[model samples]
Target: MTTIDHAVVLGGSIAGLLSAAALAPRAHRITVVDRDPLPLEGPDAQVARRGVPQGDQIHHLLMRGQERIEELLPGIGDELLALGCEKYDDVADFSQFVDGAWRMRIQSDLKVTMFRRPLFEWAIRRRVLALSNVTVVKGMAVGLLASSDGARVSGAKVRGAPGGTLAADLVVDATGRGSRSPFWIEDLGYERPVERHVRIYMGYSTWTVRLPEGALPKGLAGISASASPANPFGVAIRPCGNGLHDVAAYGMAGHYPPDDLDAMAGFFEELDSPVIADVMKKAVPASEIVPYRMPGNQRRMWEDLPRRPENLVVVGDAVTSFNPIYGQGMTMAALGAGVLGDALAEAGTLDGLAETVQARLGPLAQVAWDLAVGADSVYPQAEYENVEPPSARDRDRARAQSAAQSAEGAVRVAMRATALYMDPAYLGSPVVQETIDRWLTSGHKPAPEVTDPTDPPDVTPGVVRAADLLEPATAAGRLAG
Candidate 1:
């Protein structure tokens, strides 16, 4: 265990509770400070705090993350499953049309648990608060307090009923996107961290339904991906308490799901596919449609900032947030806390924990970040286009817009090609669509069709059936007519 004395966490969301849980073993004392009074365990009551804006949404915790949580807080996943969080093999259990092409569910080591964000986090927070070394304090952290040298954060100054201050050996910011740690650091005379934004003009709105848990569609436990690029969408037959299933209708704002029953009907009718819309068709409304607007993905350059003060670090969405379409936020944050635990152990129970923590989280967070930007950068929305919008005037506007649309089309082609090219027998791949999505997201050279990979490298995309090796793919019905 690291010999650190006290670690103060500034947010009480999943990230905050998980951080406390991870650090509790190392720190002599850990306090989780939050602006709102987090909910208690009960099905009859669950209210969103003023602090947690998108608290009540159909959120999915990736299976890999559930594994991490099980490792950190044993039996936590099972406990969640018992508490209405439905489990399914996310990528492996469900076949996906990811890059394009209906991807067969290859038997892999990945799974996911679909749950309402508040209930899941509340469960974890309860477990965290149970730790003898941990405590949850109700207050809003306004700023940080540093040592005499001001080289490291000693604690935080919080605003509460009477306003107060709490000092600690280390300070972790678990606050979500609106975190002020960067500005606070600048005030402490350090270079402000840079930020990256991938604007997709996305919004998530959920409608509850009273479909019997057993009657829900098969393979309906998690998100069923949509194939349309213009409407890259997600549908969840999420399990809530008491046999309740939340048939969440999620889409980008320009094509947002409506709250009224008629609009709701129209919403599903317009989806790229009829699968999700059909499910919503039979579902009985348990509650009014809840609409929440969440804009572009914003990630702080916390890791890139050199000369970070001692006893100070940021974790969770404050550090980096990905496009929700990936359903990686909770899992990624849990993994981050797990890394923090391992880092504290490696730093040898010493004063350098803050610096080491960020280093460990960078690689993990970057994986999600790179994937999000690579996809979101290609969105067709006018505002989310590249950093530099067209400054040219006159008919050039139409020309540039047309060119952008063409590039976007090429992007989808590339994504589809990437999906198809991997299939050894899929006529042609590389040349036509490779990297089209990237080009669409980020203006680049026009995508051109290229020859398929060197005849056939050792590996191909489809499931390698025993029948495939001896004959052409047609025998397996994997090839086009």
Candidate 2:
């Protein structure tokens, strides 16, 4: 077996850290490079970083991603819980309004963890950094170091203090959507990866707030209203921790939410239901309102490249970035890391690993791409390149399936797909299609209107208040157990 003496990963976000973790067992040494001085201690440790522009937005740890991450860093679920992250049944705890009605909530085995993007990354960073073979370097990677023959990537070149060529047997680009891997590949005389874009013109505004007791209904962990062409406004409210929640409002097809607090409230008022607006009335803002815009969903078809440098692979948003509204970004990162781990185990060496991993990532990304872009394509104003939008019959079928969620069985199947627990193809199976068509033909009634509970139950069941969950000793203990 060829030994990996050193492996370098660029970008210290969830993808980068997870990549480093996946490499820890095989590589003798691993270095994670990022432009931000990743906070390791103090109050800033959990605060949003300047580098992650969407750090303040609401983020979800889907069931599939949670399982994969725990596999990579065992007991991370307990660590997050100990750090005050809230865990809830993905279906039962969530109130979803779509197709002009409330979706029936059916209890299922699927559980999801909710927290701010920064806190989740903070937790992962602490665990990855504690690995004996892993280290983090603060620097911006500018270019790839090519081998003398230019046949393979030798390492990366950073452009700041302690910056230079850091040699490695393997290099991974997890630098997110703005990754320079394409240009760097071109710089080495290789053709750039083909690109695809689905322009939805989506915009989001988020705020951190401490909700007054009883503001939200009992047993309800989140409230979401999906957007559509006719009604382009959407809103999601999810608990972060310690009574703080992230309230994010988004608009699609040029209907951007405002960043101003009052204007944002007005934006919320336009949703299908007034439940979110009512809760916002009692929310005390904990942080300034933050706004982010995603021009489109993009994918770089690296797997399609006929040839690529050895010892080089890309992961996470560098490979495919979805619309954040779907809450698939971090999960896709974790899934990509899993794919990388599987490729390494099977290859037993870095030879041909880059190509294998990239090819595998294509299908994995396509699943999410189809789901996200398929939803966006419903908007006639949405633009697309290199991909045709689904046919009208298909779109109508999809809408029927969504509207059929009032039936418990249909909702369970839909939730499983949403949680990424089942293959998206299952949704297209004859059994599922028949059920949806039957429900639609029978004129199934919409779920009853859901309102805030007059008496809210304690929503903090599995959470704990610890001094510092990131402390080395505590983190080590968590990992060990």
Q: In model 1, which residue pairs have backbone atoms overlapping below 3 Å?
A: 63-111, 377-441, 378-441, 411-436, 411-437, 414-433, 431-448, 431-449, 431-450, 432-449
TM-scores of all candidate predictions against the true structure: 0.76, 0.89
Cα miss at 397, model 1 (Å)? 29
Candidate 2: which stretches are off by over 4 Å?
Answer: 161-163, 397-404, 421-481
Which ranges of candidate 1 are over 4 A from the true structure?
41-45, 92-101, 106-109, 161-163, 212-229, 232-236, 239-242, 382-481
TM-score of 1: 0.76
Instruction: Quantify all predictions' global Cα lDDT against the true fold.
Output: 0.61, 0.78
lDDT of 2 by residue, 175-203 (tens): 99999999999988899998899999999
Clashes of each: 10, 0
Candidate 1's residue-wise lDDT over 344-405, tens digit each?
A: 87775557777788877776676556445545545456243223432333122222211222
**Distance (Å) between predicted and true CA of 86, model 1?**
2.8
Q: Ten consecutive residues with minimal summed lDDT in candidate 1?
A: 450-459
Q: Any idea what lDDT model 2 has?
A: 0.78
Clashing pairs in 2: none
